[model samples]
Target: MRVLLTGGAGYIGSHTAVNLISDGNKVLLYDNLSNSDASVINGIAAITGVKPTLIKGDVLDEIGLVNAIEKFKPDAVIHFAGLKSVKESSLKPLEYYSTNVGGIVTLLRAMLKTGVNNVVFSSSATVYDSRQKMPVDENGIVGNAANPYGETKIICEKILADIWRRYSLNVTILRYFNPIGAHPSAMIGENPVYPNNLAPYITEVALGKREYLGVFGNDYPTVDGTGVRDYIHVCDLAEGHSLALKNMDGLKVYNLGTGKGSSVLEVLRAFCNVEERDIPYRIMPRREGDVAELVACCDKAKKELGFAPVYNLTDMARSCLAYARKNFSGKIK
Candidate 1:
């Protein structure tokens, strides 16, 4: 299978590309290199021993997308491009809507023009209403997004469902929970500029890039006061994409996660234990649009797609530390 990935040079996309390539699939990466580095292509090659063809293009560029699709002739496309910061999304709502929403519209139009139909969308667990019961499933109510970033994902999922109904497109929407950790080889992992997520912040403190970690919202109704999320290893999340590709029949939704929640302080302790040192931290107030808990009821995915997460929190922490100590030196672009 020839697969095309938007933002494929980014953290999750790169890991997914490695998994797909290892499974004997050809991959072509289409990315603008906005938030990701070009060196990720090298890392993928180092891991998989196959250098994927990369088109330095944007998802909103319809002509560029069509040209790449025609040239590469991919059997399917995995859309992984867009702005993905919750706090930044609240500050810049228009940009989030334009890029996240508009990019999918353009890609579908290009696919319609070129007769390429299958696509797997990268949605988020934030689409679920936070007030709902714990361990949300595919049948859980959606469209209760807390931030503009999640709102854009909800809109994109709706667009895909509509297209599937009218055009019979094969689409699979994977609502991912909190994805942390790095590849076992430490070649490719998350290295976000500005560090929006907790894993990268924890890694920075371990690497001494920052002074200390910030434990936000120690007053939430969680085991600890901090927020709880289903943190899945990136490798497992990548494998979920590979599984989704095989079962993209009609419009389907699946939550990709470990089916268990971990508090923020619990994750910090895991990292500290892995790094063998205490990382300083201070309690901070919760940011706007933050939720108390977001865990996944992944029984559907596990039963249907054979998606089983083998890594525990300790494994996630160890891989993250390995990636930070190996890849991040002075400054990451």
Candidate 2:
């Protein structure tokens, strides 16, 4: 299949590009490099032995998007372009809505013009209400997202559903859980411009870049009093995208994550075990919009798309630390 990935140079998009090319698919990358580095294209080529066709453009640029689609003539698209920081979203909700929500509007308009109907959207587990049942399923209620970042995801999902009903567009929404870890080759990993998530922050602490890890809220109703989440390997999440593209027909949704939950303290311990260094941390007040536990019930994805996680917490810790070491030592660009 010939596919075009928006934001293809970013963390998850770069890993997904490698997976797609490894599976014998031609890929064209469209990105503006706002939150990602252009050097990542070289890493993708080093791993996959094939350089993807890249168009340096933003998702909100309708004319550029239409031209790229017309030129590449992709059979499908995996949309991943947007601002993705929950804390940042709370600060700049308008920017999040303008980019995350408006970008999709422009992309779909371009797709309609170019007759590209198939799309695999990158959704998030944050769309689920915090008070919903544990291990959220596809049938769970949406629209009660905790933060503006999650609210954008909920809005995007609704827009896609409406577009599917009106235009018969083929859409597959993959709601991802907490994605950690790096590629086994240490070629590409989660290197955000500004670290916000737990894994990246933990890695910063391990590398001595940060003084200490902040354990947000040890009073939560969890096993260790810290927040718990389903941490899935980035490779596994990338593979699920490929499978969704292969089996997608009309509008469908699936949660991509491990069925089990891991507490923040447990994750810190796993990293310490792998790196052989103790990470100092202090418990702080819980941030707003955080839930006690947010895990996925992935039985729907397992039965429908044949998706299952192959890596555990230990594997995640090892790969993440390895990637940080390589990146810090200038082994990987």
- By TM-score, how accurate is candidate 2? 0.97
Q: TM-score per candidate, in order?
A: 0.98, 0.97
lDDT value for model 2 = 0.92
Residue-level lDDT of model 1, residues 64-113, one tens digit each, is 99999999999999999999999899999999999999999999999999
The Cα RMSD of model 1 versus the native structure comes to 1.4
Q: Report the poorest 10 consecutive residues by lDDT, candidate 2.
A: 324-333
- All candidates: CA RMSD (Å): 1.4, 1.7
Residue 21: error of model 1 in Å? Answer: 0.4
Model 1 score (lDDT): 0.94
Residue pairs of candidate 2 with colliding backbone atoms: none
Model 2, position 51, has a per-residue lDDT of 86
Using TM-score as the measure, the top candidate is: 1
